[model samples]
Structure formats: structure tokens, C-alpha cells
Target: MAITIELDDAMASQLRSEAAARQMSLEEFGRRLLAEAMHRIQVSSNWRARNQRRVELIRKSTSAELTAAEQAELDDLQAELYERMETADQDLLDRIADLENTVMP
Candidate 1:
């Protein structure tokens, strides 16, 4: 897919300066930044799906009582999901700060 974005002259100049500082063209910089953001989103989404499945399984086994191993697995999944969600949230905030730094005076 191809997309076009229109940036004001001032913003463009700032982006150019940042690109030069990193020794990359603006296009390459944008692509790399966007790819990282997208990967984070994908990971978060996958974790959400896995978390939901674990929740469903726990619910299904609630009436019958889960074995120790099953309970341990669910606990592990919940912990991992929490960590992943926290990381994703932090990544988003960090990315926002980075973009703000680039555009803000």
C-alpha cells in the first residue's frame, strides 16, 4: 500500500534534522519507526487473544475443578499477558513522546 502525508514546512525541517542525526533518509526513518509500532500492536493483539482463550478455558473448568498443572498454566498465562500488555502500553507512550519531541520546539 502507498500513502501520502503532508507535513508543514517546519515539521518537515525538524524531521529532516532528526533523520540526518540518525544518518537515515526521512523515508527510511519513518518506515522503521512505523514498523516497530505495528509490531508492538500485533504482539499485543496476539497476547489478548491468548489471554481470552485462557480465560475461557478457566471458566470451562471452574465447575469441574482444574488440576494443579492446569491452574499453574493459567496463572503463568495471566502473568505473561499482564506483562505484555504493560509493555505495549509503555511502548505506545514512549513512541508518543518520541514523536512529540520531534515536532515540539
Candidate 2:
């Protein structure tokens, strides 16, 4: 697929600088950026879907009983969700520290 976009001068300059720093063509860098974004979107979508299923399973368990397999799946989903939350929290803290250092230095 081919697409053309008109970027404002600042954005264009930034992208060009980044591509040069990476020793890549602007088009290749743009493609890589888009691919990374799409991958993140897909990962987020899958996480949401898993979370929905986990909620449903929890509701079912509260009202009735889960099979052994269902219980295992719920446990796995809960663990994964907790880990992701922890990672996100740490990332936020790291970014905040970076900003503070830049501002205070």
C-alpha cells in the first residue's frame, strides 16, 4: 500500500532528523513507526478482549461454578493483567523522572 501525507514543516524536519540519526531513509523510518504503532494497537486490543473474558468468567464463577480449565484461564488472565499494570506504572514513573531531570538540570 502507498499513501502520501503532508506534514507540517516541524514534523517533517523532526522525522528527517530521526531517520538520518538511524541511518535509514525517511520512508523506511515512517513505515517502521507505523508498524510499531499498529503492533501496539493490536496488543492493546487483545489485552482488552482478554480482560473482558476474564470479567465474564468471574461473573460466571460468582453465580455458578467454573470448570478446572476455566479457573486456570482466569488465574492466568489475572496474572497477566497485573503484570501489565505494574509495567505501565513503572513506565509512567520513569517518564516522570526523565521529565524532572530535564527540567531541573
Candidate 3:
């Protein structure tokens, strides 16, 4: 059976606008969302299991010292994550700006 998910008025308007921009029907757009949600669910499941293993490993590393190269790699990963977060923030700001001018409220 197909499921119905309710969105608040604002989110529904945003989805409709995005679908219009892509020249897609609301049903087609919703299918895309469902597909992405499935993928995300799988990823989160894997992440949680891996995170548990990581926590176990961290608990086992009481006297572990980070080598210079390891520290550099950690710094690089942090920088990349920060940059990705910044880009996401910028995209959110742009979307909010678009929403601000919508007459559908």
C-alpha cells in the first residue's frame, strides 16, 4: 500500500515550487523523495553500527598517540566537513530567501 505523508503548509509549498522548477508532477517529485529516504535509511543504519564500533575502538585506545600524519589527515577531514557544512548553509540561505518572496503563504 502507498503511504501518505503530511507536510506543513510551508514545506508543501516549497516542494511544489521545486517540482514546478523541475517540470515534474507532485507525484513524481514525491517518488524521488521516497527513493532518497530509502537510501538515507540504509546509510543511517550503517552509520550507527559503525559509530558503535568506533566508540568501542576509542575505548580501547586509552594510551594511543596520534602520529603527525594521522593528525594531518584528521585536520583535512575536519576542514572538508566544515566546507561542506558551509556550502549547505549557503544553499539553505538561498532557499530561505526564495521562500521569503513566495506569495503562497
Candidate 4:
């Protein structure tokens, strides 16, 4: 699908500069960014589903002991969730810095 959208001059210039820095055309860079964003959305959805299962497992544990496999799965899920949170936190921080640089500089 092809879509056309208007961007302010500053935004357009910034994107062009970034694309140049990566040695890619603006269109290619934009496509790559969109693909990355879609991947992130899918990852977030998967995380939500895993979180729900984690909650269910914890609730079950409170009522009765989990089997060995269930316990291991819970541990793995917790670690994966923590890693995702850390990565997300870092991404937010990086975006904030980028925005600050754009606005203040």
C-alpha cells in the first residue's frame, strides 16, 4: 500500500538527514521505520498475552503448588518481562533526549 502524508519542513528535513546518514533513500528509511514500529506493536501484544498467563499462573500457585514445568515457565516469563521493561525504559529515555535536543537546540 502506498500512502502520502504531509510533514512540516523541519520534520521532512530531519528525516532526510537521517536517511542520508544511513545511506538510504527517504522512502526506504520510512519503510524500515514503519516495519520496526509494527514489529514493536506485535512484540507488545505478545508480552500482554504472556503477562496474562503469568498472572494466571501466580494465582494458581497461591491456591496450589505449580508443577515443576509451570514454575520454570513462570520464572522464564518474569525474566523476559523484566528485560522488555528495561528495553522499553531505555527507548523512552532515548526518545526524550532526541526530542529535547530538537526542541532546545
What are the lDDT figures for the candidates, one per model?
0.86, 0.97, 0.76, 0.95
Off by over 4 Å in 2: none
Candidate 1 clashing pairs?
none
lDDT of 4 by residue, 36-55 (tens): 99998998899889999999
Mind sharing the TM-score for model 2? 0.85
Residue 90, model 2, lDDT: 100
lDDT (10s digit) by residue, model 2, range 1-105: 889999999999999999999999999999999899999999999999999999999999999999999999999999998999999999999999999999998
TM per model? 0.57, 0.85, 0.52, 0.74
Those runs of model 3 whose alpha carbons end farther than 4 Å from true positions after fitting are 6-9, 63-105
C-alpha-based local distance difference test score of model 3: 0.76
lDDT of 1 by residue, 1-103 (tens): 8888898999889988988999999999888878999997998799778888798768968788888887888888988878877988999999999999999
Index of the highest-TM-score prediction: 2
lDDT of 3 by residue, 1-105 (tens): 788889999999999999999999998998998899999899668756655654554454466866676556556545655775798899999899889879556
Q: Give the winner by lDDT: 1 or 2.
A: 2
RMSD after CA superposition, every candidate: 5.5, 1.7, 5.9, 3.4
Summed over model 1, clashes come to 0
Task: Quote the lDDT for 89 in model 2.
Answer: 100
